[model samples]
Target: MSRIPTAELSRYLLAGQLTRNGCLYSQIPRIPPARQLRRPSTGQTRTLNTQSDPTTTPTTPQNAPTPAITPLRKQLKDQAKAAKASGKKKKKKNVDNQTVPGWDLTVGIEIHAQLNTARKLFSPAASSVNDKPNSHVALFDVAMPGSQPLFQPETLIPAVRAALALGCNIQPVSRFDRKHYFHWDQPSGYQITQYYHPFARDGCISLQARDGIAAEDGEGVEIGIQQVQMEQDTAKTMAQPGGVHWLDFNRVGLPLVEIITRPQIHHPATAVALVRKVQMLLRSVDACVLGMEAGGLRADINVSVRRTGAEGLGTRTEIKNLSSFKAVEDAIIAERDRQIAVLEAGGVVAGETRGWSLGSTETRRLRGKEGEVDYRYMPDPDLAPVVIGEDLVARLASSLGMLPDAEVDQLIDEYGLSAKDAISLTTIDNGSRIEYFYRVLDALEQQLGIKADIESTDDAKQRRALIAANWCLHELGKLVETAPGVETAALSGDAETLVPSAALATILAHLHSRRITTKVAKELFWRAFRREISADTVTTAIDDDGLWFKELSQDEYAALADEVVQGEEKVLGEFARFKQGKAKAYPQGKLMFLVGKMMRQGGDQRMDPAEAERVLRARIEEVHLSGLGE
Candidate 1:
């Protein structure tokens, strides 16, 4: 077989035609490329044009369209050639984004947050990701003949909560539509979605802008969430050893809320932050635990650019199935540069769907994006309109306590955490841990019998909250981060299962009373966490582990003071001259440095720096060096 021309292979792959190992993987119903195989998000799609091979140089038979490489592989070649010719190259950024002299890039994201539920959206089948292949499939899930979708009432609850958390206006009436798509996993031939009317819309989320001309400083940027639709997720498709694709229907009909944001994001950091904010919000409400690796949450990003300060949105291309926050940022940056190069080279940024591979920096065109109409979206006759009552919406809204914004404010105002640290503590990824931390604070205050009125004083509360926040965010978080499967419910267990909240409080309280050093407090907290060691064992470790802070008795103090005065007699004369303001070599407060020689175990809670200063000053006074105050 002759080598396929790069451009010809690219065009064919862009058109969704591919062959591998003599098996032709045709575009199965040629569904809209931007939407999920099962559920759809806020996006535009294009009509597929079924024309003959457009490449004039192709010689391969129609039966075998051997694509030895991916579509983006060809695009990368084109990008490289353009860079070589124009003398402009892709910018490499490890810390910050490089400036593009004439272009401004904008991005938006669509998140499919898989609902954490036991059953599929429309069927009673188990929606377990770990279940055996096809073991959890229901008749409705597989589109068994004569099986119609019976809407699950429980599905709308989480969607409403997610929308409320996002500050969206819930629609009283939303309808489902049939979306035509082709994939073996989707045996139904069509997915039921809210194409014409979504469940919620018109919400906004605020994110910290990168401090520069790209974003205004001091003020955070707010991106609009266009709409969130409640839809079903598709099944998993795995490629076998010999070009065979296997479909697992176990994930079929899983609940998902497709969140679409407006294309106002300008910086890659902002884009990643926005994705993280959404993840935080979802976890706060238990609406979804969209871990990127769990396949629970995924996003498709749309990016486009234009001449700086010059116009309406440009032709956009999408990067799909971004699984992590870093992936979200990196893919956007790569796509932004690729589109800039294409436009600069006198080419067009095609309206197409692309896939991002973790192994490559470039994006591969998966299929040409289609408009909603191309999917032939029409009302699903089998399902009725989803009606939400005022009471139900109100209930969900009321239940969204301490959302990202409110939680951040409370942490800053009440807990006295810095704005940056507050943001980290309030996010959903660590949300459960933070909540558990708060409970420990309350339990600690109660155990010590600290009155609410007394402990609620701003200074008192903030001091305690800071201590708790520090331990939780630093020590506990480090442990949790390294702990496998920390994102799961097992990690969300009650504080008692780990270290009891009161036990944590005891550590902090001991720290405050100087009974233990901060270093020892952290160690005790860690040993007591997970309830592996008894509370009494934690207390005893302060002594047995030699963590007790040592204090100098009066005799010990006098001995050190006498030794310093006599041994450094020459230095003492220099100090006397320095104090007289006549002869000074280095001036940075002579007493603190003088006492430095006498101090040991800086972390020792029992050692008082002020006492050391007082002792040293008094001992020197016996030698009549009284001008040190100068």
Candidate 2:
């Protein structure tokens, strides 16, 4: 690890770049794709993949095929079947008898989230992860023989806010301890973590049981939080299979908050939901990004199974550093079933730490799980206890803007949106998304001449808000997904980035009143979102694109309908069938496309789209009544 260059770490991490060796090095507060930049001091993780060596890797420029996916349950069943056919009767029965009924599945999780601060906990080396490995490292980070550890109070402020958000009690005085461990990444020989006394305790997360492993995003059930403590991160260790491991000390000495939950979560769905909610809430406070796969945030899960009403806990195994929420859920379910299988076959479960392989849908032993006594932890003699005064805690607490849950409630109560819609709008785990949502809503109301402070008695305001919300959630959401490079910055809460408020308001106003078709609105929106158009460009887009509300009279509609039917006889027979009472499909799908074509006939979007359609339908009925076709 020490042999690796510091520049390599900073480059790959801060740039979020794919390294030469194909390892995953992510920088916290990921910079824009347009600019070469690193975050102020954020998190980065080392995800090494030996198979990604480009030298040995075969290249297919296009059409890279994907492997077939087998369901995890199917995979497990197949494994059991294979064992049975091989005359491994004992192991076969153990695997085959792994039913989950009546067995209590208990899970507890320990999550470490990197604080979004500007400097290291003890040094000023820009705490960010850079592509340059040692670029962010201070002398103290590498254990310069004469360097001493210093405390940073700024780090504690976020720690307390994170705890407050989690409903934990903040302690006035918290002590640091030296946790002795030997890992290639820990250049100092021991990690500075909270062992005996932590900053906050007695926290709880309330949620509801989700439906299944595939649909675990819903909130459910109440889970008790044990504690959230502050700690310093160790350096990153990039390993080469059966070879030397590379170390990047840039991550060393960064502040991290470890949120530990109780073993009361017996449902896989609950565990997944809790972790996701934690990520959302923490980000709301701008505490940590949780960087899951990128290393800003990760969870260590403890899994055990016992009799439904058992008096004692079953032997448990720990899966270390399961980053993705999906991985967390799948690991717990797989491990729980495995424990059930072993216990049913009268084999004892091993108390070990395991590593999850996403490709194989299984877990393998990493080492025997370590307990508190194994570390021989002691108070750090060099550092003194961190003291938090009431004034500081109060100021920090009062400064915390609306948390995620509060925002969710506000969306539901004020806007009259359903809980499902409200959660979807806010739970995307991106702070910029929610910020943009309300900003556009406010702009829409102002464009409609409603004051920001006054609640309009007109239901029209609510209707407009719904339209804006729908557009923001659906159309804008798709834009971000499909063209994230263009739309990400604007949606990322940079007011000056692109897509000014006035243009958004104009588009939403036109859309809400059915003055323009959704297609027309989207065409103009992309211009704004990509910054190709400036403020108040919606009007120009509408005028230049020949898009305007045209209320067609019955005769005008009849003329266009006649032209369309004569030009294309495709739907004439269908229209005849509607008159013959053989079918009641008057709202023909083909007619809608024909109507759109007639409205766009002159290379212009002209018409109150809904009214034009209604008039066109009436004209068709008139043709049936006035004997024009019959």
Candidate 3:
């Protein structure tokens, strides 16, 4: 190769028009001030290469004419026109089948519930909430350097019980993967979750109409669970005004179970029912806290709308972080209508994530929907695959108690309680009321001086069970929940003090033996609930033959009825005047007047009004006939 002098090569490379005009070194590409070069034609634009001679101009054959070059401006306009046409075609295609008079809504949910455990899933740090901010964080929780996750075996115990309760097929071997994302709440820029292999799958919850959380019809419905996997929770991010956010690390690294459901829900009610059923199952198995209002449970609802008889599903939108059943219901309805409206307006619904406010009726877009590729899921290198043995699962299953539905059925079939009564008994406080129900039954049997078998078909025992259920649910539940002037603390304390089951059984026994009316028994119930009457007083009153309540037997009522008719001369005269006044209809008002006098004769309100009226009429007839004979 020939080498040029350093000074000459530098002068040629650094030469400019300004250098030449100023009589100094300048760039070499110099042209006249007013002259310019035209852009090369599309067909004449040559590819730069070392094999081609720069001085030669290539020519086409005479037989083939030169191709016309399109203008740059016109080409841009054509491209925009084609893009617009393509977008219009897509919009029309989406709207064509979606614009119908009636629309059907389909919904699915993904719920994340904080597992009930003492410690974090992968760290030894204690798990708690509403404590000092960032207090629960550990080295691995914040993803410090050289820190690795150590899986806690205790978490799998409750998780297995929950899976068994929900009728899930527990996997023998499950693995964790790292889902990569960038967010302020994620310290590691990735979340450890069960993606390709979850701990459990293919579970279902049976919702009964009697529970009032199922379908509108009488039959029951089952919500199918697609999968339930364990994952670490994200930190709490509180957004403030002016786009500022505060992060609380205490929530980060908490153990959670992400439950994904299949899209079988066709109505908002069904969706709410499904969530409640799952919550009940979790609570029954002591798996998750599920205090949805307190951030222990969060659900993401996927909703879509399609025209009736449509072949496939339409575009779906997800409403994230719904913490209540009302929010779940309202968000689903609002998003369904929104998609239907967009399709009916000759527009396309964008696939995106959305958020819902508690009182708002609509959903706001959070972001465009992210596909699986966007998450960049890969197996976690540091974590080992979780291996659950059959022995462990069997042990957990054996420890499980009877779930709420079975308890309800037992209350109905064995105890002879109504369906509504049985469900109410088992639904409150995770079947605490039902436990009280059994206590009341045992107490009632002991008070009545008999030991009744629950499985026996004795009418007396069935009657007693029904009576006890009514008192527990209608009277006790009402007073505990809404009774005025009742101390809340007293109601929450030991059941023996808060209207002892033994005393309540005494009141029920009086009502069952026809010694007192339901109204009188209710009065005694409140007195007992308020501690105005003790269990000793209740037993003493029974021993003294209704000293406290003044309950009248059938013979006592008959005697009182006759005495009032014969003793009240003014009342008898009033009846006689009414009978002789040529009135065709019977004087029910006068009869009630005599019955009232009989009720007030003993200065007590314990007399049965029906019995008083019946006996008083017979005595009045006997007196009138004797008067005619005289």
Candidate 4:
């Protein structure tokens, strides 16, 4: 056999491939080089002419048939024309009626809150956030060969409690399904989750007007809970140097309850409030560690927008792994606006998963969202169905304890607290703050000789209670968070030990009765917190410093005021010049100067500045009037 020459073989192949209309390479006329391509302007489609003709120029003839447009292209063109015409119509309507059109926003959320338990969902390994990376993994967690799942009550009980607390209808028999996905963080190719039959469903969390900025109506709004499912968590992925990633399997197989909400949230603030309420609910039951800052809780928000009266939803986007309340609101707003802008600008919004950076104003696309079919869900052959007995449910319900809402109502009705303050107290630290608040209230009541009657309309008692609440929550809470040399963790369970409730009550008692000014009370409170004074000796400390106020008779107050006025001549002259319209300084400044002198001479700045100013003003007025008459 003889091999063909390299150039002849290439020529033959090119001739066979490029020949058209049975023309040989040498006889065929070559088409002219195509013109430089021009980019189409915005909202215009660019079409390239691909027909072959040597005699014709790059531009097609005016009588040539229009290019055949596909159904998709024609649909897109029609949509663009409709968007522009509708935009013009809406603009004209707005101009005529002086009213701008509005877009209705709808938001649904999927929350993954880590279940609080001793072990992983299907393994005996411990579930912890602070454990060494990859140190807590078991054979099953890493998907080792022949390692079977072993579900325990520790995982199910907490999820059940959480679902019950949310008023969910618990299914007696819920089975596990495998959701298939390929990711570096997942050891197994599929994750075990409750899909076809979730553990709980058909619950709702009520949002009050005071709960968020969006709930303006007094009756507020109710956000429905679609379902709650049990699932296994994926491993933690940490970005390494040099564009690498490291996966820690410790988090794999950890227990999680995915709470799905209905698309009833219309505002970002309402979404935030719902998340907060969920956190409070789970933490109250001790079922989950819903700590957003600690990665224990994450939310995926689905946001969409349409014309106010449009029937169906617009194209929606999913914002994934929002770990903060602010991020939830910001991501929803950003995605909602992006979809609205796309629609108004004659473009369609694609359904995709997006991500939000810490300080970013807009969301960036991560990947196209996977549909139900993409996950390829199937029942897990290895794990058996989870069956809950009515006895177990009954026992759990009996011990359900008080939830955050109940605590909020109790605080409001019993303690005379405002709704906002009541919510704050009830939600913080899983109602631990409210317990501390009650202790402080008890101490204050005992010290002030006030009866502990819930129905009593005693204004003085309620006023004292408010005083205690303000100091404990505002002042002491700040100290607990930002005190130097004290770890925040140390202040959690033993917060009262830092400054005993007795000491706090004493400070409040003195401040309430005007025995000491607010400044002195704060100083005393801080001193007790720092252990400068013992709780048992708080009264002694105040007395020794001469900071305690003694009720003064009328004559006694006048005498003390006259002595201070006669001694502070420079301050008096300044005040007199101001009274005669000669001094440029404000009158309050001269009065404060005189009050300071009185407090200093009186041996303690703890005296009420207002009382000192009033007394000194009277004495100074008497002297000035006598001198003017002379």
**Per TM-score, what order, best first?**
1, 2, 4, 3
Residue pairs in steric clash, candidate 4? Answer: none
lDDT of 4 by residue, 1-630 (tens): 554455444333222123343445458555443323333444432222232344554555789876664576677677668878776532222113211258888899999999999999999899985776667988888666567998876799999999999989899999999999976567677899998999899999987877764733346888899999999999887763323345567888989999999998877778888998898889888887657867889999998889888899988889999999988877777787788889899998899999998756589999998888999999999988889999988999889898888878876776678887788777666567777788888887777776655444657656866787788678876777777866665436445756788788877876787878787888898898888886578788988988766655566667778886676667777767766778777577777776777777774543566677777788777865356421
Alpha-carbon local distance difference test for all models:
0.73, 0.73, 0.75, 0.77
- What does candidate 2's lDDT look like per residue over 1-630, in tens digits? 344456664444333234444233333332223222233466544433223232343344577565476787888788878877998635322223224668878889999999988888877778888667767888778666667888877788778888988988888888899888875467677888887899899998877422222232344567788888888898887763333356678889999999999998767766777888888778878788646756799999999999888988998899998889778877877788778888899999999999997634468899998888888799989889988899987898898888777777777777776666677777553666566678888788776677868767646666776777777677766776677575546444444355566677778877776677777788778888777765566777778867776656666766776676665555766776667776676746977887777777623444555666676677667663456343
Task: List per-candidate RMSD values in Å.
Answer: 10.0, 11.7, 19.5, 16.2
> Over the stretch 41-103, how does candidate 3's per-residue lDDT look in tens digits?
433321111112223334548788656767767876786688787775432222132222588
TM-score of 4: 0.72
Q: Would you estimate the TM-scores of all the predictions?
A: 0.75, 0.73, 0.71, 0.72
List candidate 2 segments past 4 Å from native.
Answer: 1-99, 209-219, 240-242, 418-420, 427-429, 480-498, 530-532, 553-630
1-630 in candidate 1: lDDT tens per residue? 666555545333333444343333342333222211322343433222222333322244779756665576677788678778998755577246734678887888899899877778999887787865667988888666567888889878888999988889999999998898865556666888887799899999876542212342236888899999988888787764323345677888998899999998877777777887788788888898657756788999999899998879999988888998778877887888889989889999999998887646678889999778778888899888999999999887887776777777888887899877777666534466667777878866775578877636789778878877777667666756665654453355443455666677777777766667666776677677656555456567676777766767877776777675666766677767767778856333666766777775232355656677788777776655764667
For residue 108, give model 2's deviation from the true position in Å.
Answer: 0.2
- Evaluated at residue 311, the lDDT of candidate 3 is 79
Give the candidate number with the greatest lDDT. Answer: 4
> Which rank order by lDDT, best down to worst?
4, 3, 1, 2
Model 3, which residues run further than 4 Å from truth? 1-101, 213-218, 238-244, 452-457, 481-497, 500-503, 506-524, 527-537, 540-605, 608-630
